[model samples]
Target: MSRHEALNPDDHRDLRIQERRDAALGDARMVCIVVPAEFRALQAEYPILFRLNETRDRFSALAMFGFENGENLYLADGRWDARYRPLAIDIQPFLIGGRPDEDGPKQIHVDVDSPRIATGDEGVRVFDKHGRPTPYLERVIEQIGELDHGFRESGDFFAALQRHELLEPFTLEVTLEDRSDNRLVGYHIIDEARLNSLSGTALAELQAAGHLEPIYMAMASLSQFSALIARRNRRAARG
Candidate 1:
């Protein structure tokens, strides 16, 4: 298939999901997926989604395939890069199902990679400890974005897999790979959401199956329900 054809339009996203899962399971390559808050409501209605996550409050969500490739993929804003690898994964729960604290707006914090020092505010070439613009490092920097105190960003891996927390189970890893004499650093966060939604017997089935911990349960459902109304307009225009 042509590269563009390889990607599924938003409407056929489910088909692409199955294809990726099948490929990962068949190849035994370690794969991770994240979902966004926009789709969390779908999981609530269909409890089946929780089967994919690797931990609680974090949504790695695809352990069954057991595909052991270390490379990470990122998808967001309708773009996908199948080759970016994250060096670190961080998680912040939205504080759902708990007493409210007057700290700030409820949200989750997902951070990937370590902070990098920039030459100046404009941000120039990424330099090595020896002051060299490493090509691979540049690509990594561009793909992952420059890291700094003000730029708290998580790669799209967590965002894409946010929806999948309802369907898969998996784990997070912090890894460093050595290419030549330098080190490439990265990490991930993962889990399934069912552990948080089940109650009494229905909940026991998942727990007995070694699936417990609901990442979604910790975070309140999206309060701005009207945003979905905006999505309807886009869908209508497409139609």
Candidate 2:
């Protein structure tokens, strides 16, 4: 269970967050939610795929990290190897919250139970001695705002893709050097054929809506699959 509390200087004056990346702090995940705004940067380092929500009524973008559950190949020696991390991942242990009636300004809430919460005086302080938010806290607030906005806007992107019939089911099969076979299912990728078949007007509409660039970026990100496989192979060799 998570214990979330509204972040405030008075309540968390001495709160320190451990700014380190490690599996123990919940960074070892095979995938992270991504937003179209981040596609340009994410495409350079990770394969961007789409998956349906549990209700099967919505689609969400994902940044693939590894082949299986609980495995993040980008994590090595307690550091994230990627040059850019998705906003969703960077805003850890903090989330936007509002009143129970949902009729007020959104406030920052922290998960007090998170392992990232430091137990000693060894981490980044959230507030200075005078109860002012430190620079680190300000950055976290900015990240939280960006993530919130991106998540809300993603619905439009997914709806556009569906309207244009541009998503297709994908299955990835990999054979490692040690003769191990791995199969990834239940993910979707942009349909290049359908994308190319779209009418000029359709392309124009997508471009006008600012979804065209990210669509191409997502397609380009597939090239990272080979790089991901290389990372996996390297990890296996070290075993």
All models, RMSD in angstroms: 19.6, 2.0
Estimated TM-score for each candidate: 0.21, 0.96
| Every candidate's lDDT | 0.28, 0.91
lDDT of 2 by residue, 103-214 (tens): 3357999999998999888889999999999999999999877777776677789999999999999999999877788889999999999999999999999999999999
Clash pairs for candidate 2: none
- Determine the C-alpha RMSD for candidate 2 after optimal superposition of all C-alphas: 2.0
Give the per-residue Cα lDDT of candidate 2 at 221. Answer: 100
- Over the stretch 1-239, how does candidate 1's per-residue lDDT look in tens digits? 11112111232222211112112222223332323321233233221122323354543322111212542222223332222222212111001111222233222111111122122333223334454544533343333222221122222334434433433422322221221121211332233345345458855654453333333421322222123223323434555
Q: Model 1, 158: alpha-carbon shift in Å?
A: 8.5
TM-score for candidate 2, please give it. Answer: 0.96
Off by over 4 Å in 1: 1-29, 33-55, 61-130, 146-239
Best by lDDT: 2
